[model samples]
Target: SQQGEEDPQALSIQEGENATMNCSYKTSINNLQWYRQNSGRGLVHLILIRSNEREKHSGRLRVTLDTSKKSSSLLITASRAADTASYFCATRGPPGYSTLTFGKGTMLLVSP
Candidate 1:
């Protein structure tokens, strides 16, 4: 089974600070992707790291994956109130499977 679970169900921080979240999964995966969702909106793709990759970055987002440990982490640098949202980690199984298993997500609240 493919499953991903995120840690620290919730996080609170002030604007300009940093927020970090972790995810762990069961079974092998081809790639791991991170997404962000506003309170009443669809999820937005953030970044993705392949199994062969150890790290990846996009703008203010940084992601690290450790296949050996079956884990991944997301780091948001220079947080903002507008950045407050739910962050989720999703995993895609081998090539033939187009489905993605998403984690419960971590709610991040940023105050100005």
Candidate 2:
């Protein structure tokens, strides 16, 4: 079954602005991960926040996880036109499950 669903079907912003996207999941998860996809390219893993960790940052990316709410948010600071892409969140189900379920994704457009 699908586990994660991202909020905001789409987003549009200018370069240098900040873009934030959210994801909500249905089941308990061991960890949540964010990824970015450029056009037809493969997804690029951005950051992974474990259940035990509430927040994490990687370069221009910030991620926050609220286990009780079964939600997570991703923030991209100083966005650029190159940052235009689709963002997806993935969740790792409880133990014994080897696969991760990904959300539908939020399509972001950063205009120059």
Candidate 3:
């Protein structure tokens, strides 16, 4: 499967703390996207950094791509209670079945 596996299946942090998640894949990919989904809701696109890029950031989120290692990491700074959600990494694979494959995700719980 052209899917990435994320680490720390679950996480809990205080509102003022930061949270970090990691994702690792087995195959080559064209791009990787980060998404956040609230409980029982669809995922919301957070960031997309192409294979050629090394790092990308949006607001309180920072993403890093290391194609050589076939891994990516997401960091959320100064997290708020509202920022609590599941984080997933989807990979855009090459050749057939290029559709994005999602990781199991890391459930983030931000305590107020």
Candidate 4:
């Protein structure tokens, strides 16, 4: 079954501003990963912080996890037009199979 779901189906932002998106999961998981999809390109791995980790940051990306709430948030600091894309969150099971289940992403548009 599908596990993760990102909030805000679509977002429009001005260049140089910030963008924030939230994700919610349904089941107990080993880890949650975030990826960025551009137009017709493959998803680019953004970040993968495990269940034990509460928060992580990578350059302009900041991720926060709240296991109690089964939710996570991604914050993009100083956004740009090039950042316009779809962001998805995936949940990885704890068992032997490491397949990732993805959610319907949030389509972000950054105006130049």
Please give the distance, in angstroms, between residue 1's alpha carbon in candidate 1 and its true position after superposition.
7.6
Tens-place lDDT per residue, model 1, 1-112, is: 4399999899999999999999999989999999999999999999999999999989999999999999999999999999999999999998999899999999999999
lDDT of 4 by residue, 24-85 (tens): 99888899999999999999999998999999999999999999999999999999999999
Q: Score residue 38 of candidate 2 by CA lDDT.
A: 94
**Clashing pairs in model 2?**
none
TM-score of each: 0.96, 0.97, 0.94, 0.96
Local distance difference test, candidate 4: 0.94
RMSD of each: 1.1, 0.8, 1.4, 0.9
- State the lDDT of candidate 3 residue by residue for 1-112, as single tens digits: 5389999999999999999999999888899999999998999999998989999989999999999999999999999999989999999986565699999999999999
Question: Evaluated with lDDT, which candidate comes out highest?
Answer: 1
TM-score of 3: 0.94
lDDT of candidates 1 onward, in order? 0.95, 0.94, 0.94, 0.94
Evaluated against the true structure, the overall lDDT of model 2 is 0.94
Residue 52's lDDT within candidate 1 is: 98
Candidate 1 — what's its lDDT?
0.95
- Local lDDT at 112 for model 2: 94
Off by over 4 Å in 4: none
